[model samples]
Target: MRIRPVGRHALLLDCDNPGQVEAWRAELWRRRDDGELTAAEIVPAAATVLLDGVPDPATTAARIAGWTPGPTATTAAVRHVEVPVAYDGEDLPAVARHWGVDVPEVVRRLADTTFRVAFCGFAPGFAYLTGLPERWAVPRLPSPRPRVPAGSVALAGPYAGIYPTASPGGWLLVGRTGLTLFDVHADPPATLTPGTRVRLATA
Candidate 1:
């Protein structure tokens, strides 16, 4: 891991992969909760975690440099959310073809996987979920849609995602849900924060 100053009060930890990033983020949060660290935000991305609004960047950097990440937190320690989906997307057949399986098998496999929120990006409340095995990875569309409706469950590369709002997107759409992923009026606007476990259930 490489730690770099992100300004006067933030440090960006560059991890080797998303798994390491998740592990580090979980450990840092545990430390903060146990009164070992102070930070305003612990934001995670694809393979990095940013410690923002830190009181002492130099000292904190030194402190974390020696720390080694432990195993990922158990499921009981994280939030679990179920999103009911209508598996009737335009790309469902294509995805089935890619996996050399029928559409029903595609749905069954997806529903059986327990996905975790690896990170959130591209748009508000849009979570990049990871859990699908490498063999199930799918490619992005050749061209992006002008507007993929909100709650569209999609896939690209090795990650699955849900569109929080109508926007142009290139991921393969497999289904959609009615869950309100983002709501400005809500206290915690996003439903699927990083580290939250997610399951896509058949609607």
Candidate 2:
């Protein structure tokens, strides 16, 4: 782990991997709840946690430097969510071709694998989920679409994501879910929060 000052009031904690980032973010939230680290916002990214509105950056950095990384003290709040997919996307055959496998095999691989939200970006409620094995990782399309419809489940490199709202995208679409990923009227808005455990199933 490494702590670097982002600016005058934010400290970025860099972790070794996504697992460490998840574990550390969980632990940080615990500490914040317990009144140990009094930061206004604890934002986590792919492999970094940003502690903003910190009282003292140097003190916080020193404190984090002395801490040891391990299992989180609590896991009661981590949520497991299942997203049902139609498996009828236009790019399914292209993805299978990229993998040198049949269409059914691609669906099977997605259904059997479990994923976690490593971070959220590109759009509101859009989650960058990790868990696809390295062997199954693929690159994004050479050209991004001017507009991708909402609920389009896509894959790019090591991450799989769903389009919360239509915009532009380059990820290879393998399937789509009927469920609404984001809602302004909902209490939390987004179904997939950071650290959320997810599973894809064929509907």
Candidate 3:
């Protein structure tokens, strides 16, 4: 683990392990509940973590690395949500073709693995999931779709994600869902918070 100071008030933690990222994410939730690390926010990315407190990034990084894993990591609060989606995307057939597999096989492989949220990006409540099956992984379209409807489940490279809102996108859409991933009125607006374990339910 390496820590670098972004400025005077934040630290960038680089830990390549997804497991390590998860550990810290869960740990932060614990500290937030128990009052250990006092920060405005803990933003966990695919390969990095950001702490919105403290000035000296080097010192703080050392402390966090030596810190022990907390209890919240083991708690049942971490949720694995099953999101049901329609398997009728325009790109579905293309995905099957790209992977050299049938559409049914594509769905089977996608549902086989439990994905972890690598980062929240592109839009509100959108989570970039890591570790999609290699066979089904493909690149984005040559041209970005003018408006990818919300809840569109897609795969590109080794990642899969759901569109949080209607917007332009290039990720190969495999399906769409009616479930709301974000709601401004709610306390935690994003449905798939970082560290959330997710699985897809085909409609």
Among the numbered candidates, top TM-score falls to 1
Candidate 3 displacement at residue 19 in angstroms? 3.4
Q: What are the Cα lDDT values of the candidates?
A: 0.94, 0.88, 0.80
Q: How close is each model in CA RMSD to the real structure?
A: 1.0, 1.7, 2.3
Candidate 1, residues 1-203, lDDT tens digits: the string is 99999989999999998889999999999999999999999999998999999999999999999888788888678899999999999999999999999999999999999999988889999999999989989999999999999999999999999999999999999999999999999878999999999999999
For candidate 2, give the lDDT of residue 129: 92
**Segments of candidate 2 deviating more than 4 angstroms:** 73-77
Across 58-141, the per-residue lDDT of candidate 2 in tens digits comes to 998898787765575444667889999999888999889989999999999999888988888888899999999888888998
The better candidate by lDDT, 1 or 2, is: 1
Candidate 2 lDDT (Cα, 0 to 1): 0.88
Instruction: Give each model a TM-score.
Output: 0.97, 0.93, 0.88
Over 56-153, each residue of candidate 3 has an lDDT whose tens digit, in order, gives: 55666777778876544432766788888788888889999998889988888777768877678778899988767555569889989899988889
**Better candidate by lDDT, 2 or 3:** 2
